[model samples]
Target: MDIQKIRRDTIGCEQLIHLNNAGAALMPAVVANGIRDYISAEETGGGYETADKYSAELDQFYTYMAKLLHCRSENIAFTTNATDSFNRALSAVPFKQGDVILTTENDYPSNFIAFISLQKRLGIEIVTVRNTPSGETDLEDLEQKINTLQPRLVSVTHVPTSSGLVQPVAAIGNITKRYDTLYLLDACQSVGQLAVDAIATGADFISGTFRKFLRGPRGAGFLYISDKALQSGLEPLFPDLRGAEWTGIHAYTHREDAKRFEDWETAFALMAGSTAAIKYLLDIGIQEVQTRNETLTAYLRHQLGNVPGVQLQDKGKHPCSIVTFSIANQEPERFKQYFKQHGVNIYTTARSSAIIDFTQKGIEWVARVSPHYYNTEAEIDRFMQLLTAIA
Candidate 1:
């Protein structure tokens, strides 16, 4: 990977350090320009006319996403964000009273709330599988749960937002497959940063965002639906005209493919930007990106670990690019402001943000520094210098 060329293409590289990629990465020139050009065209030619003209480009977004996800174009549906994509996929599952959603403790907080909502609205049961000492999903406990009590769906987050903990997703997928149960994998953090194959992951539904490692603009994401899921007649409970066609007064037939998960209207400019971002990653190659990320993260962990009063908070057998740590005797807001003052980008994750995991770890909050492959080792060194002076 050409660090110079990568940093040059990223507009903010020279101005400040960006260590909050897991929150949102620096968008490259290709993605920004694509969005700007499309929006400009829409402003002059009108939205409808511009969309009609760039119909092929808009359609090609799905094709690019299909390549990234290892799925067919028909199985991809564009959503607003990872939450929207996950919600759509969750709603599609035909859950009745007493249905169970077996998940892990480190599942996304938003997803956990969604599951709780299901429990309140419907009589759905939410069961959590055991976590290993290192905070990864325990395959033994998961298999035992599936064997003893059947779950309607096995949902797991590929990477938790609170830390660098990488869940054993593929193994969980295998467990779900054994029971012939539905599986939903939250690949929002894993997709662009980590190489994720839908078929290999064995997830019936995969939800992701382009704004993170993919470096696309916000307000745009995509969902992947497996052939078996679609063939089994699963679709979003709230279907719009874009997803289905009305046949009679109160009857409608949803599309056979993943379009049934999307709404009618879409932000074409964002779609254009997302397409360009995915194309950029594909050109660079995800495997190469992963290699670069591993080196950066390893260096970060080592440097941060040695910093006085800095406690490394991330845990997993194989952690990804996200690096979370708590500074003793430092307020989270203070930590956030200190980095901001130094022209560094990072986020402070609160215990409320991830109650289960945070409460278990006994920390009120932690500062998150998520770096991408585009970042330089020199930047990490400077990051350490600034952090060492934090006391």
Candidate 2:
């Protein structure tokens, strides 16, 4: 990869040592410009007119995402963010009283909260699978739970937000397939950073956000509904006109495709921006992006380990770019503020973000520093020096 050329295309590379990619990545100039051009057109013309004019670009969001995820364009639905996408996918599952939704202890917080809500409202049981000693989803235990419980849905976060732990989704998919259970995957942190094949992963429903590793504008996310999911006739709770046609005074027909999960009104500019950002990543190739991300993060982990008082806290059999660690004697807020004041961008994850995982690991909070493909080794070294001094 041409790291120099890629960095040049990124807007904040020169101004800040951006290591908060897991929170929100720095958007590329192409994506920013694409959004700007669309917004400009909207201001010059009208919202509907601009949307009609750039309809192809807006539609390209599905095409690009389909190509990136190895699925049909008809299977994609654009959403406001990852949480919304996940919620839409979850709402489609036919949950009844005493139904089981099996997942990992380290699953994303918002998703777990949704499960809790379901448990309260519908008497659905939220069953958490055991994790391995090394902090990965225990496949053996997961299979056993599936065999015994016959869960209504088996959900897994491809990469949890609070840690760099990557769950074995494909392996879990294999188990879910054997049990004939629906599999939902949250790929918010892994979509652009890794090459994800939706079908190969056996994910009936997958959700992702463009604001993170995809380097796209905020307010843009997507959900992928498999052919099997479409055939299942699963419908989200609330379907707008875009998702369902008002055929009669009290009746409507849901869309045959994944659009049944979408809202009528959307940010066309954000959609255009997502299209450009995904196209840019496709041009670079996901394989190459994954390689660069692993290389840079490996360097980051090695350098961070060398710093005294910096306890490396990532726990996955195959960790990627989202690096988490804690200062030996400093508070998470203070450490985050100190790093920000020193022109090093970073964020912190608290126990609330990963209650089960953090409690199990005996951590109150930790700093999360994520590096993208555009970040350089020198930037990693500079951040390391800052962290060393703080330690």
Candidate 3:
């Protein structure tokens, strides 16, 4: 691996020990500088003129995202963030009265709330599969639910926000395909940390943010809609001129691609930065990055487990880069603040962020420490030493 190139790209290593990659990975120099350059152009040229001047670069955003997710460029749409992308995709699915929407218990709170709100409004039936003993969605229960209910949509988070557990997305995809159910994957945390092939996952729609493991600017994300979805005429709830053409006074035609989910206005500067971020990740090779992240996380977990009074909260047969834990008699916020004071960055997850899972597990809050490929093993050792000292 080109360690020198990686080190040069990431400038944050010198400043702080960042362990919140799942929340927002540190942006590389290229992405930060790209956004600055775009903003400078906007000052010299008018906003509209600047966008026109860099339209090709903005267009490359979709192309780069498509390559990252292994889908066609036409099947990709840029969104404000992962939540925005997820909401848009959910809105596109026409939910009728008595329709069933099946999901896992570990689903993100925002997504769970959206489903409940839609169910109340549309009178749709919402079903949640039982979790495995290990904290992941039980495959047997999921298969049984699909066989019985034949849900209108099958949604699952590739990686839950509260823990390091990675759900069996490929297996779920196989089941969804067998039943011809519309599959939607929430890949907010898994996109850049793991290899996400929309085709292999068999998800008709996939939503993810660039800020997390992608290490891009905030307020930047993308969605993937399979060709089959486009052919089936699925569209956003409010399609604008950019998404659909005004054919006549009372008629219109939606685009033949995933662009139908997008609006006209966007942050061109952020899009440029997102494009640069994607290129940087691709250059490093995602497979190698995933391996590096896994190794770092494993080392962190092992060290944390050895610390007195520190209990790792993540439970699963296979885990990702996220490491959740709690120290005895330590409030989540206080613990996080302690780390912050020591120049270490981490995040706290309250029950509200993942109410269903946390509430069920009797965990009110947890401290999350997530590492990316750029993080070193030495950082993990230092973090462990701090954790031990605190304990």
Candidate 4:
């Protein structure tokens, strides 16, 4: 793949140093133009008429997503964002009293809160697996927990938002398969940065967003439910008309496909834009993207490691593109503002985001810089120079 040509297609890099891809990636020109054209068509014609005109392109959304995840189109469901998909998938599993939910300490805050809320309401038990000394979840401990607890469900985040540490998801998936446990994977950070195959991952369900690494619109996401899950008659807590059809006064029928988790109305423009974005990534190739991001992150880490009083917080056997660090005498927000003033985009994470992981590591907040495939080595060098000057 031509790396320079790919970077040139992302116009935002010319205006600002965007290192906040973990938050939201800049949309490529093709994706932006696609969304604008769809909106213009809607204004010129009626909503229904405009949809009819681009029905084939809109349908490609599911096809492209399935191709990306290496899953069947029937197993995919369109959602507004990762949170929406995660919540919908979680709601589908019925949690009775004393049911156990085994998760990781590095899980996203929203997911942790959701489990806590469910536990409070339904008398379910929430169990968090211990993390290793390097901040990744301990696979041995996780297996031991599963053997002992025999939990109702097993869920984990492939790549956590708070840090760049990649969890041992495939190992966990192997364990789940051995015991016939339901596995749910939150791939919000890993979907575009790494190869994701639902069957290989052994996950019964997976959820992710398009705006992060996929560089799509902000409100586009998806969910994948295995055929076995569908066969088991798992449906959302509150199924809409699109998800279920009212057969009679006392009966309803849910769709056999993963669309059973989705609602009737959706943002068609965003859907089209997401499809274009996936096509753009496919054109560049995911393996090439991963290689570029890993190289950039390693360069960034090498430069940042030399900064005075700066401590890299992310520790794992293998890391992705997220670079997180904390300065000895600087506040996270103040440091972030310094970077902003210098035209470098970054973000800060508090202990509340990953409370168990942060507190265990004795960290309050840290500055995070996440780079994508479009980011160049020169940009990483410049960011490091700026960090040194500020420090």
Residue-pair clashes per candidate, as listed?
Answer: 0, 0, 0, 0
Whole-model lDDT, candidate 3? 0.90
Per-prediction TM-score to the true structure, in the order listed = 0.98, 0.98, 0.97, 0.98
Query: Which 10 successive residues of model 4 have the least lDDT summed?
Result: 1-10
Residues 1-391 of candidate 2: C-alpha lDDT, one tens digit per residue:
8999999998698888899999999999999999999999999999999999988778888898999999999999999999999999999898899999999998899999999999999999999999888889889999999999999999899999888988888888888988768899999999999899999999999999999999998899999999999988987889999999999999999999999999989998999999999999999999999999999999999888888777888898899889998778888788888988988899999999999988877989989999999998999988888877767
Off-target runs (Cα >4 Å) in candidate 2 are: none
Task: List ranges where model 4 is wrong by over 4 Å.
Answer: none
How well is each residue in 1-391 modelled by candidate 4, as lDDT tens digits? 6767777888988889899999999999999999999999999998989888998989898898899889899999999999999999999887789988999988889999999999989999999898888878788988899899888899899998888899878778888988856899999999888888888888989999999999999999999999889999998999999899999999999999999999988899999999999999988888988988888898888888888989898878889988898888888888888888988899999998988878877989988999998888887887888888868
Off by over 4 Å in 1: none
TM-score of 4: 0.98
What number of backbone clashes does candidate 1 have, counting pairs of residues 3 or more apart or in separate chains? 0
Query: For candidate 1, lDDT tens digit of each residue in 246-353?
Result: 999989999998999998899989999999999999999999999999999999898887878888899898899999998888988878889889999899999977
RMSD of every candidate to native, in Å, equals: 1.0, 1.0, 1.2, 1.2
Q: Who is ahead in lDDT, 1 or 3?
A: 1
Clashing pairs in 3: none
- Enumerate residue pairs that collide in model 2: none
Q: Alpha-carbon error at 30 in model 1, in Å?
A: 1.0
